[model samples]
Target: MTPSNPDPDPYLTPGYRPGGATLPRETPPGETPPAEGGTSFTGPDDSHNPTDGWAAAPLTAVLVVAALVVAFFVAYAVWFVID
Candidate 1:
């Protein structure tokens, strides 16, 4: 007989937890981290992104902004003293 209150999902009941969501198996000895995004549910974390370590930070751009901020403060102080 079917359950009187049938759930929407046939494969997953209210309390079901899939094996893939369980903690990962330990690496035996000489193996690398488990495969990502193939048979496994998780892809590499952002640290493992394809673009990881691809570009240096744009220090010149940041320095330009920092210079502008310093100049603005200096000008404001000078004007305040002269006024």
Candidate 2:
């Protein structure tokens, strides 16, 4: 009789398995993957859009007040130097 086979990788021999490993089932052509398996978005699509007016009003008011304070100081210094 001939010698028996020692290596049994499925890739090497079509009908053989090295240690009885199971292969994943094949998907049919043109079929979409199941909902739980498909790719998904991780965050909101409109995350860059501006917020509502109520949330932005306070920041606008603060910037306007800061600009007025700076303009007042600059005007006072110029007048004092010129007088």
Candidate 3:
């Protein structure tokens, strides 16, 4: 013979509770719930182009050249002092 199930419905069993707080169906004063089933988001139309600002290639080239000039001067000074 099959053993009888103590709690046939696990949901109805004692000490077996569902997670999360129980929220009220009623909306707060001066606020209304959405009529639609899913969410509808509205946002501003803005550009997200990363290359909108100053050109990175030109800036990087200028910085590299400046660094090389400074490095050359430092090497010349060290050589002059040693020689």
Worst 10 residues of 2 by lDDT: 24-33
Compute the lDDT of residue 40 as modeled in candidate 2.
Answer: 73
Q: How do the residues 1-83 of candidate 2 rate in per-residue lDDT, one tens digit apiece?
A: 99987867446533334566444433333343445744577557875867566666788899999999999999999999999
Q: In candidate 1, what are the lDDT values of residues 1-83, reduced to their tens digit?
A: 86577546634433334553323344233334445657555656566547544244576778789999999999999999999
- The superposed Cα distance between candidate 3 and the true structure at residue 27, in angstroms, equals 79
Tens digit of per-residue lDDT, candidate 3, span 9-30: 7564334437733345432443
lDDT score, candidate 3: 0.68
Which portions of model 1 show Cα errors greater than 4 Å?
1-41, 44-57
- Which ten contiguous residues of candidate 1 have the minimum total lDDT? 22-31
The better-scoring model by TM-score among 1 and 2 is 1
Comparing 2 with 3 on lDDT, the higher-scoring candidate is 3
Evaluated against the true structure, the overall lDDT of model 2 is 0.67
Each prediction's Cα lDDT score? 0.61, 0.67, 0.68
